[model samples]
Target: METLRHIVLFVHLIGFAVLFGAWAVQAFGGKREFTRLMSIGMSIAAVAGLVLAAPWGLPDGAEMNYAKIGTKLVILLVIGALLGIGTARQKRGEKIAPAVFWLVGILTATNAGIAAIW
Candidate 1:
């Protein structure tokens, strides 16, 4: 249904927000809060993304635009991976370079904007 699709889309977007916000918070605050918030948010976001990717029977063709959506998904995955690395590093009491966080945040925002249009 159209409504279901929209709801799924909304949830997916929220996931991205969680991820982006987590990284931003980490960038500003110290590792303590960063680790806590980022972990929780990323978990929720990843689950929501999985839910949104379900194969619902609609037209069966490109629900949105595969190429654009694919690009956005790729970017998100890359950011997610980077965040995961950051988390791992944090666990070892090592701080990742701040620029990495900034870059991830910027890329996430850009992907979100692209997703909005495409």
Candidate 2:
């Protein structure tokens, strides 16, 4: 069970990497549009994160940090929303606001920071 937990945690980090890597490529490569890869990465991260939030493999008497989990969940949801909105708008020949594009990257980094620090 502990090994499984570690595997899931590795996957969670990979998801973050994929999401951020895709965003970085677009943001710095002269294009600021959403891609399917971003959505896929988000899904991976969200699912793995939810799994980690559970207490399945934890040792006895170890309490889960609900507050931190909740905070990260909320941030993830916001990132999802932004991705959806930006993608939809882009598909309709609309230009996504610079703020919206930048926020996605900012929030992604923030989420990783929270996971690492808290």
Candidate 3:
């Protein structure tokens, strides 16, 4: 079980890389829309995060930081929604605001901050 937790955490990290890495590249390159790959990576990270928390849900000696996790979840959702909105705007031939890109980029980085500093 311990090994499984570590594996899932690693995957979560990988997902973060895929999602944020892609975002960073696109945002820096002046691309506004969310890539399909980024969405896929975000989905993977979100699911793996929940799975990694499964053991803590057990009625045993397991303990977890629900507050931190909840905060992280909200951040992740905001990033997803922002990306979705940006994608919609792109599809409509509208430009996504620069602030939206910055917000999503910073919020995505905030997950790492939450993990390290929370």
Model 1 C-alpha lDDT per residue in residues 5-116, reported as the tens digit of each score: 6787677767677767777776677452245555566666656666566666356575645677568668767777877887688778887877766777788788778866
lDDT of 2 by residue, 36-112 (tens): 99999999999999999988999889999999999999999999999999999999999989999999999999999
Steric clash count of candidate 1: 0
Ranking by TM-score: 2, 3, 1
Residue-wise C-alpha lDDT for candidate 3, range 15-117, written one tens digit per residue:
9889988888887774656788788789889999889767543446767888998999999899889889988988898988989878877988989889989
Clashing pairs in 2: none
Models 1 onward score TM values of: 0.73, 0.97, 0.89
lDDT: which is higher, 2 or 3? 2
Instruction: State each model's CA lDDT, in order.
Output: 0.68, 0.95, 0.84
Evaluate residue 77 in candidate 2 and report its C-alpha lDDT on the 0 to 100 scale. 99
Model 3 error, position 52 (Å)? 1.3
For candidate 3, the per-residue lDDT at 48 reads: 92
Query: In candidate 3, which residue ranges exceed 4 Å CA deviation?
Result: 56-62
The per-prediction CA RMSD against the true structure, in angstroms, equals: 3.0, 0.8, 2.3
